[model samples]
Target: MRGIDVEVAPGEVFGFLGPNGAGKSSTMRMIACVSPRSEGTLQVLGMDPGVDGPRIRARIGVVPQQDNLDAELTVRQNLEIYGRYFGLSRAHVRAKAVELLEFAQLTERADDAVEPLSGGMKRRLTIARALVNDPELLLLDEPTTGLDPQARHLLWERLYRLKREGVTQIITTHYMDEAEQLCDRLVVMDGGVIVAEGSPAGLIERYSTREVLELRFTPESAPTAADLAHLAERVEQLPDRLLLYAADGEHVHREVARAGHRPLTALVRRSSLEDVFLRLTGRSLAE
Candidate 1:
């Protein structure tokens, strides 16, 4: 993660947005104190990670990209065991486990074995386990990568509650919608470097137009960018479509039809963080 600099404010949800191997995970590991930084200075919670790894870890929580619950244990036991690692009393951990089960909405599955639970339940358990110490800062790495839509929404609600209680979050994700919905401020990274940094609305306004008009044409009959050049401020021709970057999508679409460049389908929508990413990296976010 060379040439990368970041600062996260208290009680704010900060994000690292990029594709796979874009150094998002590497930066996250450094912040978590699980990996060492080879160069440059990094401080977390007003302490150097290398000098105070254990001290910093005790005051923070981490939710990894993958679920790593103990398969043989019951849902509630997982929380208890992790809490004891910090030298908390068994009685304290037991009560803490009860409270966390309720927090994660897993009170009914308290005794159920971990392996048979659904993906979302396990993820919630992992998060609940991380909060046993009630850390001040929370680190999440791709918190909702593989879950279904319903599961993703549920998790988002849980995270929102945490934010209301003033837990600072540092999240790494490749999902554009997730960053837009969750991050108060974020940085766009590609090739081990940060390309852009701002709020979602600010980034869109700075790097992209207010609206985009997407026209899909078949490969055999695809029109060149110049054919629609005069319709908008800029034109981008893709493998299956042409993007007209304009402030007013409705008017641009009307002008496109007037120019006799009919496409198979046309879609007019607001510009998104994906558009900003495409403008910076010359590739889709999914790439």
Candidate 2:
């Protein structure tokens, strides 16, 4: 994490994006005061983590990359126990547990043992637990890494609501769609360094065209970027297909046919965070 500089504003949903082992976790841990940085200035909530670790931690909630729930405890008890660890009154903790159960939509399963719950349910419970203290900042690491589509959307909605409540959040995700859906501002990290930073729309506008035209051709008949250079602003060639970046996708698609090149499959869609990442790192976000 050398030469990395980051500044997160209050009441903003800021994100760190990178592929596996790109040092996103290392940087996040430093900010969380769980790991010490060899050298850098890190201030969380206007306090230096190096000197005020305990105070900083008390005001923040963390939802880690994986769930670390007490499997033997009931859903409600899990929240209650964690709140007590923060020295909350037993009565307050118990009432907070009920509120969190409803917030997580787990009121019916309040008494269920943690081990039997599904992955998405466990993730939500973990988040609700983090909010037990009513911290000012929330740190979520890959919060939707392994959920089904419906579960992912539900989690996203909860996060959106949290945003409305003005809980400052810092999230780290490898998923471009997740970053786009949740981040107000984000930075792309590669090999422990920031390569790009901006709001999603701002980054896309700076790094990519408004739309992308995808053309998949047979292995033997794949056309070169040089052959279609005049049709779009830029061309990115992948193993299986070619990407044509242009403001007017329909016009570019039509130009492809007019140029006497026919692909096996063609798709035209708006540019995404994936495109911005690919442009910056010369690699797919999936890679």
Candidate 3:
């Protein structure tokens, strides 16, 4: 919403990493050509979204945060009908639906009404429907929200396959692990602004230490950031735990013990995208 500038490569996965209400969805809508921006110029897939909205939309696919499939229609019928909107031949749509059913792993349930399918099945069908026209760019808004672990991983694998097959993808998500796992390059957006941008590992290396020591204490015995400042490069105090950022977590843990600060539980782990976000935004991504 505020002077946002980003360019996604032809075959790479680009991501918008942010918490709720950080303008991720609004930005996605503009890129999808569904919502026009009030200011500044915009280009998607080499065309201005305002002047060439229809042409841009014809070559792009969008999977919204919610599944909007017709419950009365069968899984295959859903894809066929969506393909028809793009003016594809009926023969092409039929064959494409068959291929997409296999890709979504719903071939056996192709004839079943969408209302009876599992949540994962519905999510996959939504994504398959988005691909019915063989879009050059795919925009997914929180593609795996509210799904079980198995379903989430299955979707991740499908996305990986798409990347391998040269489909350019833009994903918006609050899940730091998902962003780290799926994105080749990403921008960390906060309050309608890009706070940082880089590959996940690059951002981690730039913004966070190599390791983090997490110490959880009883409410009465918790140490303040100032109390642990000498033990690590940086100390962050949270309601549940204290994060000690350091190049070596074990060394910081040993120092904390030497300093006579005992915690209920201590964990030494590698830094993550979450840590990078916390460092950049001064709050957790879930916030």
**Steric clash pairs (candidate 1):** none
Q: How accurate locally is residue 202 in candidate 3, as Cα lDDT from 0 to 100?
A: 97
206, model 1: CA deviation in Å? 0.9
| lDDT per residue as tens, model 1, 136-168 | 899999999888999889889888899999999
Residues 1-287, candidate 3: write the lDDT tens digits.
79789989899999998878889999999999999899988888889998999998989999999999998789999999999999999999999999999999999999999998988999999999999989989999999999999999999999999999999999999899999989999999888999999999999999999999999998988889999998888888888999999999998898888988889999999999998887776664445
Looking at model 2, the pairs that clash are: none
On the 0 to 100 scale, the lDDT of residue 136 in model 1 is 88
Give the poorly placed runs of model 3, Cα more than 4 Å off. 219-221, 284-287
State model 1's lDDT. Answer: 0.91
Per-residue CA lDDT of model 2 for 1-287, tens digit only, reads 87778888888999999888788888888889899877879999999999999899988999999899999899999999999989999999999999999999999999999998999999999999999999889999999999999989999999999999999999999899999999999999988899999999999999999999999999888889989988899998888999999999999999899888889999999999989987887674444
At residue 253, give the lDDT of candidate 2.
93
TM-scores, each model vs. reference: 0.96, 0.97, 0.96
Report lDDT per candidate. Answer: 0.91, 0.92, 0.93
Error of 3 at 251 (Å): 0.9
151, model 1: CA deviation in Å? 0.7
